[model samples]
Target: MIRRPDSLKTFLQAGALAGLCALALLQAPKQAIAGPSGVAGTALFQQFPLLYQGVLVEGMGGAFTAVADDSNAPFYNPAGLDNIQSSSFQILNISADISYPSLYPTLYNGVSGAGNNNQNYINAFSSVAGQSLYARVGDYSNYTTHDFAIGLLSNNQMLGVANASPTTTNLGSLAALSDSGVVISGAYGFFNHHLQVGGTLMGLYQMFENIPSLSKTQASALSSTLSDNLSYGFGLVGNLGAIYHFDLPLNPTLGASILNVGTANFGNAGSLPQLINAGVGIDPDIGFGRLLADIDYVDVTNYLYYTGDSLWLHTRFGVQYQFPEILTVSAGLYEGYPTFGVGIDLWAVEVNASYYTEEASPVPGLNPDHIVSLQVAFGWM
Candidate 1:
């Protein structure tokens, strides 16, 4: 058991700070946050973008075998770090995801007797298009997320990934976006007890461009205006997990982690933030991390809670094969898109790529969308 230090006051302060960080994380360009960005609207609506979706899951095809290779392992499965044999190192993870959301307003509207001119239908399209700008009020812009991450894991903490952009809410000050970053994650494990727990600390900043509101005549012009600033708040995400090594010839291992159990900020929204992700793997013999095949349930992005009555939940299935001399494969499904990808490690470089095809098009009359994606990963171990 981890002992509690004397002051309850100190604990509260740290908790408060973490909550604020959570809030800052959800803040970003409005409509630009749909799908994986989280739903837009209300405090809860904006809270979705803060979800991590477990990035490393991509390489392993959603399989977390070593658990320690990812710095964010604690956020996904706390028990992951328990398997780590190394002391400290810096790791960089960068993935670019592109998504084109389709609109079936005509079908829904026609069936519901709400014509194309229906206020409800228009609002839906306008909502998705104007989301991030709507909340911020003036930055009327939309683009898929271009993500970048840099991390360092040492002794007990994982650091990097600054989420300073105002995504869910309209902070109005661009600089506040810089203040919110996540880092310094720590873990505690009773390896013998088979129980391990980990936690993360977050910093928050918020700001936005005055995009303009419905009531303003010159709201369009406001998009050109920009502002920035900082605020202090806190919240936290945690992992509670255990690994059981069965007494068998193959010695299969069972493991589970309840992630985001620790609550963090939700911008001004109340928090009930918790994520539970689990995985299991068996090893013939453990060498360096290993060449194994595993599959898992993982989130590609957060589902934003739009209006009090509307919510979007986004998640996917990840299947992967590892430790093979040939190419490794990964397949996934999200929203209405089906994706297949591949990876290969040669010499000292890793090359990866994926393509997507939509279940149906959004043009109301045309065929569903057909899209493709390409990506590559490189590193030196």
Candidate 2:
């Protein structure tokens, strides 16, 4: 019998998710001293956008910096690897199973760009109502992310919930996560055919576990687990890229890049600020495989937050195909306009099983949701 207004509506939904993670540590943009709005302004522990989209020309549709090379042109533009005569290292991976109020399953891991599947098929058919249970969720919901980049990156991202039921329980370790971070990059290439440029240095470490249970076999009426206050800092990310190719008669390839404008400090509650991205890529010479496209622009809103308000300004598109050339086909679209995924490519390995829906209100998000992804890469030239 857990009363007291249901424990004050579960700490007001965990203090409105800790005031959106204390306003992302006071709208972090480096330059310090921020975090206040009760529980720091809570947004569920902040740091949510960016699950490995560090350039690969945004995986297909978002295109590739002029058909990216010398292995990802130093995070998409170390001046396009300044015509790297030769010298390379590559290994990339992306995994996912994202479905919100839409398809009904949720496990958002790292994203590799290119999405929009008819608004996830009309939010998975408008999350069924008749008998309920379509993508039904509640116990801590879902969100997962991981990135293990070698000499160029060593990823980390986590959202919440691995357990939750009639009375709530998640004893620990689905992979015990609350928040994680790390990204260190450096690149330089010049002339001949590759003109690349690079810069990246970001660090993050987080752990927030506030468990409060009072039923489900009332162990002590209200279980315990509380953690917070362990933020971090350090930012000066940079990337300016270029790639141009025209061997003619379809030997066509074009690329352009701009990423992470600056700022990143998570130390004394402040900074995740500064972000700018620009893209374009074309790889033509048609045949059985290889076709790409991309476009991106993010100001994070208010042109740069003063108190921000409803802004996810998004525009995404993706296309992939390895065809009889070895089987690999994809599709895309994003933001409330959904229409998202599908994948599989053996050669260098890429997998994203299936996805497609257009919401007819049987149950999903009322209709748009279906996503899957798996990626592994290696090639040194």
Candidate 3:
């Protein structure tokens, strides 16, 4: 049964989440490392850090800049907060992602004695080199009403890549990163709701550790703990966004945003580069269900660097269909890789799953890493 709660209860729920976020940001454990975090492993890819990437948004090929209408609005494009019709609060949201297609088989073979049985060792090592393997876990919660939103988000990931050069004595490189933060956002509508402009401010606590080069002998003799090499930092970031709705067929909406304006600097560690993204979303009034389609050009500034010689890696396209209050399905292309996702909602509980591939090497189609993600959430609307 659905029983509407009083405003006081809603406010209390929001406050609890707020307190938790504040505590997380202020009470991070201190680390006493001398080297800067991510100094080694991150040399492979020059991409920026995304403090919060909602599962639903990523499931849709990360094309939510123009279609950010849900709890993810505050992180994607705060201007979409104006689309909320009523108050909503999320009590719990957790998600995890891991590389798929079973890298385990080959990894196990290499670890066991079977890999060295013949020239198979060379083949296996060659295949694994330069390939990125990763796992991630995250939790998020938020409260939103009308044109205002606030949320807490945390994400942790471990990424590794094997060394391919013949001159290097290192076995591989590994990096662990964590980000926890609070985000507050606000927006205002103009021209009778035809346009919306918004801004977001985020306070973050981050920690990172990287092992640039390590040999098997050194690994066997290692004595350092996960915290021994860890480095910590803090940052304040901002985002600005605007959306314009056209009064034509399909109800087209054009959106643009600048994330981490002027870059998000974390002292002693590193910084997340600024990105400008633009996209368009359309909602067609069809019978029996809701349909949304989006096309986006993300990180426009890096187009020349990422796609000048290789395949275009900045385009995203997605489409989703929702069946009333029960199920939702989505599909799209993320940087030329296919992605699919599904969601089921029951009462106040929701479950979502997605499958996609990420290009780890400089060029697309060279080194693809298959990944799967799952999420569970509890909320009140």
Candidate 4:
């Protein structure tokens, strides 16, 4: 927890001044450009990018490509679906996260005392503080030989500044973005079940709304009409994956996948980038539990197509221990940040929880964001 100083009001004054300067820059005119210079680059991709899915994978720090065997295989390495023996179904899966609001003391702490003059600017700064919510519901079941699954996923992000004045209900400025989609996935095994291949198709819808910094004159009327400014669109994308299991000790597995293969677009809004990912996993059975370790290399093409920045490497490593069928514990480094999670099985239901950190920017120097997620899943073999 951050300690609050008695001079927090003074800090708010300084922050308000900074906000004014930033607003000035945002209002400046732009030049017409083309090619790479015109591209929005990382900022565009950072908005609502497809995140690593599933509480188990997140707890393992997103190193599940070769270890995928459960319903989430569709998002990780669909080929692993062939490993399933029973026709399992995930009745409902929902997950949500929020950055620790405690870090932004200016917005929540000592804010009620901010002077009327600094309140608007404080709100503006709070609007872009990186807050988001996500939820998904899906089901996966195996057939006689081939395995298949379908799911619906949605995400929403909001940033805004709200007035601290007791008499006002107006938000100073706001931006909200959302994405919703359906995924269809299938997998097949060959070569005596040594090699498996899988694919996923997605249909997506996206929406975004931004309410510009409010002027005193427009605040009253604009506050009431903000919903009218929303814009939305739809598009499609696909993923292909394969995994190979070795006949050697520990049943080590190697996996590879191409995600967002065709650079799916959301009409004129934007496009999700194509990513190439590969991973390896080793699971050795111990007397009382199973020890699992996995490592992954992601966004392979980003190094060649874009600049050779280290962030493009996007490496992840994780280790997990499963105590029979009662509980599982995991810890990992996700793109260099620490993550921890656990799963508990009770009868026919499983509950999972994880804490993960994400860098606001791959370029460094930005503060990290923390999220805690809890998921409940019910299924029967």
Give me the candidate number with maximum TM-score.
3
Model 1: lDDT of residue 104: 34
Over 255-334, each residue of candidate 4 has an lDDT whose tens digit, in order, gives 77767664556665555555567788986656777888899876554422222365622777898888877799999987
Choose 2 or 4, whichever is better by lDDT.
4
How many residue pairs clash in model 3?
Answer: 0
Each model's C-alpha lDDT? 0.35, 0.35, 0.70, 0.60
> Rank order by TM-score, top first?
3, 4, 1, 2
Candidate 2, 1-381: lDDT as tens digits: 112234455455445334433443343444234332311223222222332432223334333444444334444444444443444333444333333443124222111111333333223222231211111110111111111112434344322222222222321111112223444444453332323344444344433322222222221222332223233433344444444443345444344444444443444444344333344445554665666544433322222322234222334455555455445555544332333344444544544443432222222244333333333443321
Alpha-carbon TM-score of each model against the true structure = 0.48, 0.28, 0.81, 0.71
Score residue 183 of candidate 2 by CA lDDT: 46
Name every residue pair that clashes in candidate 3. Answer: none
Scored against the true structure, residue 22 in model 3 reaches a CA lDDT of: 41
Q: What range of 10 consecutive residues in model 1 has the weakest lDDT sum? A: 134-143
When 1 and 4 are scored with lDDT, the better candidate is: 4
Least accurate 10 contiguous residues by lDDT in model 3: 27-36
Score candidate 4 by lDDT.
0.60
